[model samples]
Target: MNFANTGQMEITTLENFYRDTASLIPEGINKEIGHFNVFKIEDVLARQNKKVMPYNRRAYYKISVISGKNKAEYADKVIDIEHNALLFATPKIPYNYVPQDDDQHGFFCIFTDEFLIQSKSGVVLDDLPLFQPGGYPIFQLSAEEVDDITFIFRKMYKELSSDYAYKYDLIRNYILELIHYGQKLQPATTLYPSHTASARVSSLFIELLERQFPIESPQQKLNLRTAKDYADRLAVHVNHLNKVLKENTGKTTTDIITGRIVQEAKILLKQTDWNISEIAYSLGFEQVAHFSNFFRKQTSFAPLAFRS
Candidate 1:
């Protein structure tokens, strides 16, 4: 989400999202494994708290129950939720919601891909149609459906407070059940418009970039790390690609690519025990020294030093 092409759209991380949405520090036992969180709007308001969500792509999946009149603006479509409804959001899309009236009511929860991976399914959350590109991610709820959805949220909140060892496993199943419930409502209809030339190139460039990610193992090396590689795949001159990116995101192609790699490097260093060389090569650096130098330049810390 930190690419050059993202102009006014900001990226909201889980920690900051919690602070903004609920005015909480996200402390306690789950701080280290802080990939999941839940909040009720009523609870937040009763505490006289304020919500501060801007238009952006949240770095996680958000499922919520909303009531009254509210509007959600996505990349391709604008949806108005009336009465009770369920809404789904993914990282691939940038969106924001504005309350049309003072009667907003809801429960919301956010979880990262890693949160779901810990479950038995062993699947990537982004690969699911519910969160995939050009897929439907919203549903309206009847009063009965609202009751059912609220019940699911109640189970999640209750399990999250329990001492059960397998609570997350049960929570994951409930999340899946909610997802399947939405999927069964009707097939996902593509709402995104066809891209313009510059927009198309940028979109293709992003898709090509994300394709190299998650770096499943040390044996997996990133294929597209430079501006030239992306330009070639997009069938455009490298200069043209760079110009479009700069125009769209206020950053050159190389800057955007490096930012993404460095961000990934930090994530791997923080989340996994991968050795320096493994992390280095997986990110497409030829030598550990080069990766070390790059990481230091970008983050002001040596690789192992950062890990420590």
Candidate 2:
């Protein structure tokens, strides 16, 4: 598939995916996943993109675990997924599936924002960390934790297909429970924090910084990826964010943000076959020359030189 800027499905209706995959569900099992009908499929076919698709660009996020050997190409990273593990998939990202040797046990339940976040839970749901389209999902749950989660999903399946008035509400609660459990499972990253203004700002700033990194598309390139852009989004002055970062992390906001961007640049440069111009564009640099100048100033080497 053409991975660059394929708006093939923008926030696809979950109901339609359910209808299409209806035949995949095994017979005679009532499975409820987030207030919608749950379809359990062992064989899944989807698109896989080259390293140019946006990280947050996906219609639905997936949580999967399998024992059979599997291979995935995400950007410049090709991973051998052969053990019990959990990972995420965004709708905007292009990905494909291959089941190895037919000995695989996997479960996936698809839901839209409508199904997950209703009136009461939507506000809190917005703060959830895994839902971040661009964030990481490398949590390694303990065997007990995995079993617990599986049991919850099994119960959710039963509730989903039942004819009950409050099934939706119960599903919402179950969804919230899963999110809470995930929050506990997440690494001690700064993404999970107590409620505080500065903490909130820091979290938002980190998200904004991550969104620009591991550059994905040319048109989505970063000409204006700077502290000011983030300040505007946070509704705080640039200096204020810098001060917050300095006070919070012992570094200026520019240092932290630029450091993150540069780190990603180093990874893409050294690892990917994508050229300098492509990397620059993905990082939102309007001109490759400008990106080169900035890269040299920060790392004492031009983007191309560093890659070589």
Candidate 3:
């Protein structure tokens, strides 16, 4: 959870984010935001000895349009944002931003999902392609896009202090507009556009597989644990999924599925104290014996022995 130079930070509140960097917060702002707030950094270098933000999950969603140079690290990818860039941040993912020099300045807004979901628009934030974790959330904006985005953020800044009763409705519209803009540039037409059919199928298959993960409780069983199940969910034939997986990864669909299941099983065995039967049941095994045999075949060790 800790980065190399910077210690560690788990910022879940707006005040904690703004308190350390007073330059970012504008004056005359209502000192309290029940769930959301917008801040524009007129001078990014105002704070001396600025440290890099480490990868951490926060309880807020952030959309920032930065107009300078900076490097961002998200999960396993590193992105260099030159000129003006529109970046999206979500609570489900971890990310980091390292400012380049003194000239890094931009506008960023933070809000809880409740802020938008409770609005009259009834938008499902996570369901949007722009907000989805695996979808592209960062864009190198054209000058016109920058101007358009800037106008929205500026409107948000002005409306934050407005006395209008329906100002929030207008602000929500701005937020949605920003998202739609990003979506228009993002891979809304296709999640991954590869050259070969094998690559596309592989990428899509992996995405579909990942959508079913991070099993939360014993009461919740993994629904798609087989190649056929995944193929059905992805609207592809089982043979087609197997062929593409073999072509791209040099492994059959069943092999990939089994390997992933074994990895998940090992994690559960090592990280949780769930009994073998419960773990097996949650992993889509009807009986503990079947799961034990499968685990032993895959790992060359019994589940209990591996756990011990």
The C-alpha stretches of model 2 lying farther than 4 A from their native spots are: 1-41, 45-56, 65-82, 87-102, 123-126, 133-135, 159-167, 187-200, 207-224, 229-240, 246-252, 259-283, 292-308
lDDT of 3: 0.73
By summed lDDT, the worst window of 10 consecutive residues in model 3 runs over 1-10
Write one digit per residue (lDDT tens) for candidate 3, span 1-308: 11122112233345556555663443333332335678766543355346565455555788999887888876445899888899988865567677776576678888767667756677777766666654557899888989999999999989987887777767778888888788788753553456687787887887777666545457768899888898998789999999988988799999888876776677567656789998899889999999999999998999999999
TM-score of predicted structure 2 = 0.60
Clashes of each: 1, 18, 0
RMSD of every candidate to native, in Å, equals 12.3, 7.1, 8.6
User: Please, what is the whole-model Cα lDDT of each candidate in the order they appear?
Assistant: 0.73, 0.58, 0.73
- Runs in model 1 deviating more than 4 A are 1-9, 22-34, 45-52, 188-308
Off by over 4 Å in 3: 1-34, 42-51, 191-208, 211-308
User: Tens digits of per-residue lDDT for model 2 on 1-308?
Assistant: 11133332222334444444443432322233332444333533322212121322334555554444555544324566665545545443334344454455545565445456663654444345665533554445556766777776777778866777677677667666666676676766635465677767877787676555435443455544678988998899999888877766788877887776676677667645677888777876768898899889999998777877
Model 3, C-alpha of 58: deviation from truth (Å): 2.1
Best by TM-score: 3
